[model samples]
Target: MKTYTDTGKKDTRSGFGAGLTALGQTNPDVVALCADLTGSLKMDEFKANHPERFFQVGIAEANMMGLAAGMTIGGKIPFTGTFANFSTGRVYDQIRQSIAYSHKNVKICASHAGLTLGEDGATHQILEDIGLMKMLPGMTVINTCDFNQTKAATMAIAQHHGPVYLRFGRPKVPNFTPEDQNFEIGKAVQLQEGSDVTIVATGHLVWEALEAAKALNEESISAEVINIHTIKPLDTDAIVKSVKKTGCIVTAEEHNFLGGLGESVARELALHHPTPQEFVATNDTFGESGTPAQLMDKYGLNAAAIAAKAKKVMGRK
Candidate 1:
């Protein structure tokens, strides 16, 4: 087992800001569009540094998405920033029609995702954004776990011309992955290797998987941690190999248990190698006002929850 920790705590959105600022200087066509939550989305730095390239659309997310799509027509790669719900669900039609359907080069950067958004409650926490965004045709979905990967992904997605949904979170979390790590869309990062069970997770849940693996290690259970950052074009080869070795699986995510990371992994595993699988996520229920840790426990989205699911899956097999 491997231990990866952050130097200190850093929110993934801060990484987005750093990446976007770097993009502003490196890429001339890179422009940012933010709703009222510029500070929350970490777009204030981009707006402050390059005022000319930043567009504030008030509290209108739908219009911001449309403007981003239009900017693509003029050969501009516009990155629209907002909360997860506002970024995807609120402006889904606009994205589906103007961006995904038309294949526009727009970067949909969403922050404060999943149950981790905390205190703001269910209305703000978007556990189904992955399912919604990934369903759209030609839309690329990428969820970064920590600070380093988020920045790297932001930078990488900007270079790739397509309708991309880059999801991060508000609170500080693990910053484990290498700062200069290369991010490949549709690829999964193998954090730890094991033959007992394969644990596939994404977003902040990736850190939970790592923590769960540590607990499993204490119990003498060998567990593999596979970070499925890109939920859409999943790393099928890695998933198959891990499942083939373990013969059982446990999927973890901050999203709902249905139609998100778990379902995607289950569908893939069912087709390739039918195996017993358990899921650690929200039980299709709404989130409540609480701290990140409290919401995780209440929603069944913590390391202990993942570890329990892994044990059950392995025993079932």
Candidate 2:
């Protein structure tokens, strides 16, 4: 097995903060709205720099979405910030009706998504937001992998003239990828190329997928890892090509198995190629209060689980 370089650790939310600040300077029309989660969502930099352009709505996520949608009417690109649960499930109607339905240029920036939110428990940790947002019309759903990619996505989404759901996490994990990498929405990054199996993952699970790739390599099983950041407008071509080469698939995510990244990939693969596939994700249940590692192990979102699932998917029975 070959050794990969280890980058320093950093939280993905910081990337969003950094990108928002850079966007505030680059685009004067960019406005920010927060539901009293500035620190959690890491929007303080943008709020402090562009105070006049930021609206602190005081824990009212629904109201913040409405205001963000309204701001889009006057040539303002509003970014509504909050946690994943509140960003989507709590304000689905507002986002669906006012933002997606009305065609508002609002960036729904959600932090602390999935089990990595750690110690928040099930009430706040939402694994279904991707499915919820992706179902909406004209909504672009993105779950960035690391700090740099999230920053790049946040900056790029500001230039896109429509509604977008940008999801990131709170845990300080591996910070791979280039510092100034250009983030192209709807495009997936091919991490490791292989022919045995393809592992598609998003958010915190991308690092796990990388770890699984190393493990698979040690076991003499070549596996391709694809960072599927954009769940809504999935990279169908990349998935098709990878599956065609690999002949099997395993999906990993820090989200629920029912309506998250894995399901999206499964739905696409089912149509294009009926390949053997397995999913390493949380089943139909709520999250629990524990350390990130504990929850990940319990919910089967770690590297070993992904590797095991990959072996199973390839019919290594």
* Highest-TM-score candidate: 1
Which residue pairs collide in model 2, if any? none
Q: 62-165, model 1: which lDDT tens digit per residue? A: 99989999999999999998899999889888989988999999999999998888999989998889999888988888988999999999999987878899
Report the error of model 1 at residue 287, Å: 0.7
Question: Which stretch of 10 consecutive residues in model 1 shows the poorest summed lDDT?
Answer: 1-10
TM for candidate 2 is 0.97
Question: Number of the top candidate by lDDT?
Answer: 1
- Candidate 1 ranges beyond 4 A from true positions: none
The lDDT of each candidate is 0.90, 0.89
Per-model TM-score versus the true fold: 0.98, 0.97
For candidate 1, the C-alpha RMSD (Å) to the true structure equals 1.0
